[model samples]
Target: MDKNIKIADSMLDLIGNIPLVRLNRIGKETGAEILVKPEFLNPSGSIKDRIAKMMIEDAEKSGVLKEGITIVEGTTGNTGTALAFVSAVKGYRFVAYTPKMVSNKSRMSIMLAYGAESEAIDIQDYNKKMGLDADDDSSVHGGHVELLPRQICLDLERQHDDIWWARQFSNPWNVGAHHDWTAKEILEQTDGKIDAFVASVGTGGTILGVARALKAHNPDIMIVGIEPAGKAMMGAPDEYPLIPGISDGIIPQIFNSKIVDRVISIHDSDAIDMAHQLTQKEGIFCGISSGANVLASTMIAKELGQGKRIVTVLPDSRDRYLEVEKYTT
Candidate 1:
């Protein structure tokens, strides 16, 4: 109530400036110091808030998004929730299409809570409706199980003047947000001494964007990308992720191979195990993709040895996984 007190005009103002915290117990055995950006601290409880705000504001500047238009996007969950959060604040209607029975129900619920429409697209159901066999390869073209939802957004955008698909996978602003804000904050926090940067590849925006900045600051910084076991996100021809955190090997357009030095796959079990370790040992309380990133970071930390510093991101909060029992089980 003090006149001098500072306050945010909107939740949008709290979306960035997420602080980096050092891991004390979990990665101590690795000898190298592991620092994690607690991106879940963002307003919507995930790093996607950064891109959601960026994409919407950029669209406003470019006149693609205007009053009375409904925003549409295909997401696993985080991006949809983030966009819903932003749209609710900015007075736009939001519609998120996610793969049916795949995304965490908690996240979809959060989107709906923000007054957004959350639709689950059942691929096999659509295939059957379209006169294709349930097992047809074309049903999930590009080897991505989530393609059906994206196609729905595309169709809606093409068919309606009031519909604008955010297209986070290919959107330049998705990369721009991290490159301009997330990476800058990391550099400022770490003083540009990062020896390695690691993150789970969802849409591939975070790792690629941060890698660009970290590489420019210090070309020696190793950029490591994490993939769910069997998913070849870094240039391999045919493989897909098992966990919902990683994408379905449909390499996002925002991802660039030039900045990435390595792609490591972590099993779902290993990721879940590490998530528990992060919660119990380090008090991180992150989701499975965060587990994948930290596990891979620990691997790199050991390889880098003592005195090396590695940075990664806890992409979302454990609350999203609470009902799914991904961490509880």
Candidate 2:
């Protein structure tokens, strides 16, 4: 964050340099020191803010993005929100394509809140757009939707001449943001005492990027990856991912498997249960993926109990996922 720059100049200025807080309640039983990087404090309310800034600004520097071009991408989650936030403050037009799920409506609302247009691209229709035969099991693969999002970017960019496709999943700037700002902050915040690093694989940008940066500082530092159970990339069954924006059926182009020392799978029940517990005991109201990271951290803490330090990333807060309870008789 550029402190000398006026906040009103651009909210993008307040994107990175978040805080790291010690987990008192969750880590207490495990004995190992557990710390969480509270990325929810970011201006866009998620860690995606870091990548959004870097990607768009990098495009500007490279002359790929201009004043009139529309920034198009596929997401209904934190990445969409961050891009909408950045475009809102930075004088760029943004359009996002998401599956027409009822749950996606809320995320669309958030993008609309920031003046970004949210279009519902029918999943089947987008599959056709990607030249895939929906009926073919080899093509759709019992709902093989891993590439649908990015495919939307590819389609829109080809059709529309003025679209600046922010290919977040494969974008180098995505990794660069975490490597330059996020990893450096962690090193500085922890005074270079980080024993292990843990995070979930979404675009695999965060974990891979931060892992490389941490290892660059100390090769002895342990790197761990958490994925929802059943993600194909991690050699599991292809069940639906409980945490949205965590993973799909395919491995992202930007992810580096070699950067991870350990990869663990978590269940939806365990993640949600831990999320509730975190809210009640630790007072950390984080997103579901954050809970998964916490659950992973707790396991690591238990294994290396006492005297070791473990750090993980809490991707976002709970604001976007909060639901109104249905009243009962």
Candidate 3:
């Protein structure tokens, strides 16, 4: 046997450990050495793969999921696609739902390619479809974001006994995955030299989990949380953010405001422009959130000065945003 030649038994084996590429062009301009964790290389195409595998395997061990069970969750795109891919490999059915507004057909198509089902429901129709009484007033999880997908998950859980809800937003495994794998990989890849960290917030799993780990390793590692400029999740306005993956209406149960040293909000136009700039300047084909991360990283870098290694995550590829003209065009 060739000792250097090994093989992965399944796609699940390729969840974590992505490349950390230094930003040459952008870093030079900002006078800060920015490095990116290209999470798009994950088998499912985003950092969601890490938590997806962690959540599913943990559920399997705890008997919360089994052969006859159907996995379900509400996701804008990434997490749903991750679950869809994992469920397919584990021989289970998966159903995902997203608010019609945030829904991306490209991501849903990828999920369908993996043998998963998807639904895009109108936010205005949520009250009726979910069978809620006018007297029963229940707000969505994130303040202004669509609540249909979450309601769908709850409804399915109530209607079917053999259903496993991969609640990535509140699941401890979601945080644990990044704490155990993502953060460690970052630390190892950067050789414990990361002076700053930046990432866009969605379910808060990535920032919370990774921040805790990095802080524990070195309390001085500045952890900055990035959000869509208009959409504020922590101590800010709940206006709808233009970006899809971060700064949604509701704050995630897993997200902790205290762990983040500070939060920076980026405007949609600027974020989209920076994302385009990243691809053109650094040859990094990243999504909207990743661009947001770069925008935040550069801001921090300019403040911190040179010789400091600032790290951030490139959440996924540009596949999901190809339809948005301003984001792509």
Candidate 4:
């Protein structure tokens, strides 16, 4: 028997250590090697599982999360699904506050399946209620679209003793998870030979965390971040689209610009096209952000040319996108 094949005590125990594989066909013309970490292989079918576990456990250790405490978070889909998965396994109630515009039936169903209660907040409604115009700079700025949902989480935490907000956006644990585990896994898997890293920025935790580790490993390693076109959380104008997993426009507090070398914006059509290619050619069933990440990775690979390696993540599975977008077909 192989010593590495030990059984896990629980699903939570299986969150990380996802394998990194090279893209054989998609980036063939790039010359450089494009490696992908299929984070969808995580227990909850998304990379968010890592931070969900990390934040929850850390809160438990700090005594902020207690018996019967409900875990609440503002998420698009993946984080909520992950928190629900972790909460269900750990015996905690979970609630997800999500943007009404980006809400998808499939994503909500997965969270509901895990016994999580989800509340979709309409940004337009919130803006109207607050007497702010939809086009107002304050309401349309980077990541402002998610502010209402996060505010709801904040209110719940402040009003109820039994409720604890996961705060995945501002939580240091979100960054810590990728830095300590995800990036370490990448470094180990690649034997510290990675020349670049690319990822689609949502809460910005993944890229920020991974950049911190990869840059520390080798400062010259380029770190690139992808955002939906015109919806960049850094400085671009806020825009709406079907790009479900990223660019909801609230520049998360965890986002740090210094470590990131470049920010690339990809259109929804481009992401969908890349997603189709990934599914059809490479057999990697991933979501739109994964498409953006992989697309950005290929661009980086082409720049670096032959012999260099670029690593990126397939952030989530395609199941959440089947009902809403043409991500696969």
Q: How many clashes show up per model?
A: 0, 0, 6, 3
Off by over 4 Å in 1: 1-5, 128-143, 235-240
**Candidate lDDT values, in order:** 0.83, 0.80, 0.82, 0.83
Cα distance off (Å), candidate 3, residue 30: 3.2
Q: What residue runs in model 2 are displaced by over 4 Å at the alpha carbon?
A: 1-8, 125-143, 236-240, 324-329
Writing each residue's lDDT as its tens digit, candidate 2 over 1-329 gives 65466544567778777778898888788889999988988897899999999999999999989889999887767888899999998889998876554234556678899999877756666557778775332222112553565677898789987898898888998899999999999999899998899998888889988998999999999998887876566665565556655774667789878888888888766777777777888888887788889999999999989988999998987766766221000
* All candidates: CA RMSD (Å): 3.3, 3.6, 3.8, 2.9
Clashing residue pairs in candidate 3 (N, C-alpha, C atoms within 3 angstroms)? 142-249, 142-250, 143-249, 143-250, 145-249, 229-266
- Each candidate structure's TM-score, on Cα atoms with residue i matched to residue i, is 0.92, 0.90, 0.91, 0.92
Clash total of candidate 3: 6
TM-score quality measure for candidate 1: 0.92
Error of 4 at 185 (Å): 0.1
lDDT of 4 by residue, 1-329 (tens): 11265897788888888888889999889799999999999988999999999999999999999888999988767888999999999999998887776566787888999999988777877778878785443222126667888889999899999999999888998999999999999998899998999988777889999999999999999999887876556554545444666755666788887888887778778888898899999999998888888888888888899999999999988777787535545
